[model samples]
Target: MNSLIEDVSPIAVDVYRSRRERVLAQLRAQGGGLAVLSTAPEVMRNRDTDYPFRHDSYFYYLTGFSEPEATLVLNASARDGEPASILFCREKNVERETWEGFRYGPEAAAEAFGFDAAFAIGALDDHMPRLLADQPALFYALGTSAELDAKVRGWIDAVRAQSRSGVRAPTRAQHLLPIIDEMRMVKDAHEIAIMRRAASISAEAHRGAMHACRPGMREYELEAELLYTFRRHGAQAPAYGSIVATGANACVLHYPAGNATMRDGDLVLIDAACELDGYASDITRTFPASGRFTPAQRELYDIVLAAQSAAIDATRAGVSFDALHQAALEVLSQGLLDTGILDKAKFGGVENVIAERAYARFYMHRTGHWLGMDVHDAGEYREADGPRDEQGARPWRTLVAGNVLTIEPGLYVRAAEDVPERYWNTGIRIEDDALVTPGGCELLTREVPVAADEIEALMRESISH
Candidate 1:
């Protein structure tokens, strides 16, 4: 952890507090219950070392506190004496504090995080039975955590043991994430601000990667540049494994940056981004390692760029999520036909190729996905409980204001007798973060050049400098 973490609270305390209140209100409406959630446990990476601890998204949504072995208990059925929100966390130990940074203890955590009450984590088992007794319902994800499930059962059993004394466990249990996911999908102003900054930071990293790229550089060297740029720009880390694929390696979608040397005639596909605070921004750009795209490569690049443009154009309030993907797919299908990547005589037309998925040889994967705290952020993609269409699928959810997603359309041509030899081993992907608005959508990762000519210009500038 760095000092940057202390500054992670760009969203005011009231935002998390308000979310907790909303969860409590939902619980109260559903016959009142206690909702219990625990932060992620710190896992041991090896014999003595430990993996970097990350707080659980669900727990952090309600409480901004970022400590492991912490649990939040919200009692919707609290009486006049009981507080609505309670947090139980690791007890303070001076010896442990000397080794492991700070622990809020209980009183400090309650005050710092706006909880009504708090206690040591050690007391949770002792207190859960009393908290669960006679509640109408319990709210938590049922099967996500085996450890949490075992603890929940023990609490329920403890309440059951008191049945002779006229106490009863909760009668019903509800999954909590669906409600939370719904809340998380729509980016509020605070979240959007963080995401915007993240996008800016990541855009700079991409630019840096392009600048450092050159002929005869190993793929890993370009990757190192990306990582250095991310951290240098105050980002905690890369959003995901930085994909710095060079030459034919670009054909592998999730190719890890390795020892493959970037050659003069090859293209590098960089699918990377950065994380700021907790939100993630994703961007992918493909460009020539020699600072110039060949005719064949430039043609593929233009097609993917045009497809991304179509998808971005279709992204707005009231459009289905799938509609944006369809928009990109149509453009890409047409591009494949024009380029001879998909035989026009065999595929007939763009619609026929799409219906048959004949263009899948060079283009696969969806156009984009929901993006936020997690790269593939939470939220149902399709309409819940809607009647199945003739495709036997539920309708995709319509886009609304505050929804953020990615518009990434790509083409990967592999060596095949059926494929044009000139287009072989070329991969191009143009990705940008799209924030849906009333008019259309805002492109977040536009700081980096996506246009083929612009990329060549940026690379030339990089080489001269």
Candidate 2:
């Protein structure tokens, strides 16, 4: 490992501490138990080729350990004051290394990831029963891996066997989600730094796509440009599938069939976002295939931009998490009414339409979501009763300082005989990564040109020179 990469940032340490507190708190509440977590397994690309390995989201969130076929066990009753964080990993083999690549093995894994103890994966069955003996309950995401599930059940059954000796096994098994996800909801400085960098890089990619868009270019060609830009700027990978929809195709959300050739008089909507070291940045920008937007396109684009502005304003501290979507929906609904695209009566009243979900036909998806390690960063905004858990009286949790989310406001009009001619076949979305701060919201994507006139000006500047 490079010395530079090995020196984990203070933020990373902070994130680790936060995660530990969450897991330990749960373990203590349960009165001493063993919590087991596993990394994602590598899947095959073809007959023998294996796809590039990526750690499981929850596992990475807690341990920040990126290796494959590794399991983390937290022993709550360890003699040490602190709960034991143990990892079982592959042992280094010279022969295997010669054929494949470097393996972290047990020693390196423990030291690098700050685990209390480490052992070879081969010793799991032997170690598990002894460690889990008489524990109160088991903590793990069961059924995530069939093999792991079977192994865990077998180990628990062995513990159950002790009933004849008056040794009772744990009758409870708690899913690790509630505790882990709650920990992930709030971003520490370290996670925020990575996410900010990712947003900057993703913004650059969107800018590149904006400048590269021109008549006769295939949508996939433009997508290639955006992806190359992301990699060049050092994002780990695209947070989600890149959508390079041109003209009417933009109406199709999640459109990844990027084969359409851009035309002179069409709008190109590029919904491409990326993840940096796992922290995600999602952004959507719609621009004209030609350098400048047509009059109707500009009108609709401005409405979406205005809606996004409202959404950003709604992201202040102590504001409802859904306030932004409501604000943006108001702008969108008004714009549709002004453009005569929707019947105010048919859509169940403009303002009421949003509450009743009448605008879903065109909007299709939520205005935005929490952006972090996972694109739809793990954590629930609502409780089982579908109400805010805490944080204030807006019927939704208030936006806090460390919350980073996307403020994406879009309006898609599909081509149909009944649709107004002026608004036909136009899909417009303007998205920016907004960071909720103590004072207010800061637009992390301020660099990527977004003002209607600014986008056109940048396009002109790029092409004319």
Candidate 3:
């Protein structure tokens, strides 16, 4: 067992310690191995400067350590009785601290971050061989880090050198991500609390952006409003690039805020959110940049909103993962037919449009994705057992109580002779975070208005003053 300081983070130390214990149990179950994971390497933005540092999600999940150039080793070897959870990190340097920031060093890190033992990172090569000796397997993620792979090889090679002395290198290897990914998929009470705060902050930013938007403003000006709101409320940073698309710009799904000017009679689509602590919250809302949706714009906006509602209703524990997407798709496919986007005479009906995936012309992306640590998060979507469906592919897993996801359904209409001119260049998307529960799903980002009427009212009120 590792030593713990009660105040490691907003999350209790016991949670991380328990997670490490679970990994140990998994390792022991696999006949004793050394579980090794390293934090992300810091990348240089330019000469003598670096990009913002973020820890590797897997490493942070178990260690709760956020520093760069750090590694964790969990030894569960029966023969080599050794440290269960060990940390290797940077040693304290006052000169470096003055230029950079505080360094926990080894002794302080061991006590403060609750590791069984800690040492300067430079000593990993020297100590790894000893840890590798007599172990049955070495557990590390495959295709993750070349440096780690090289180090593991060197450690085993060092141990093999002493084989004549009865020292045995590991004969087996295993991937640690599968186990850790499953753990991250389910939200614990601590993670849920942090996510709720992130959602609230992001919701406020979306609401503010809608209020600040006007017909004459540049897209970047609206984006600045979002940044201001996120930081003003104490968010660390944007979870992803903020998309402040106006008019035809929204037709590009991944478009970031540009110099494009918002004009009257155009819809403004914003897909933005904040990362509070290490957790992330995501939300997207499309509204009229002029504080009023044109007749055609409101018609299409209502369709997208209704599709999102169907998807939200389909999200709950025991529902298959694809059920929600299919629910939204069915609604969207019908809407496309109703709007004649997919010519009703040529495409036949909703059944044929879905069968042909014809709705992709306007609504291309999936309804949503699992939302957590990374914006896309970490988790296997399909049943790991094997393919059981008639399509000969593995089926998506059923929704569980602890799961959280987004319900985003959108429409991007490009100009064409056959397409209606009024609907051309109109891109509308509505997104919200949903927490799956036994009874139903909770819409975490609803604090920002979703209904077309509510959005119009909020915008008109803000602009009136």
lDDT (Cα, tens digit) per residue for candidate 1, span 304-345: 989988898899999899988899999999999998888889
| Residue 293 CA displacement from its true place in model 1, Å | 0.5
Q: Any idea how many clashes model 2 has?
A: 0
Go through the candidates in order and give each one's C-alpha lDDT: 0.90, 0.81, 0.89
Candidate 1 clashing pairs? none
Query: For model 2, where is the 10-residue window of minimal lDDT?
Result: 385-394
Q: List, residue by residue over 288-356, the lDDT tens digit for candidate 3.
A: 988888989998999999999999989999988899889989888898888877799998888999989
Model 3 residue 381 lDDT score:
85
Better of 1 and 2 by TM-score: 1
Ranking by lDDT: 1, 3, 2
- Model 2 ranges off by over 4 Å: 1-14, 81-83, 143-145, 344-349, 384-395
Q: What TM-score would every model get versus the actual structure?
A: 0.97, 0.93, 0.96
**Per-residue lDDT of 415 in model 2:** 79
Between 2 and 3, whose TM-score is larger? 3
TM-score (C-alpha) between model 2 and the true structure: 0.93
* Weakest lDDT window of 10 consecutive positions for candidate 3: 1-10
Q: Number of the top candidate by TM-score?
A: 1
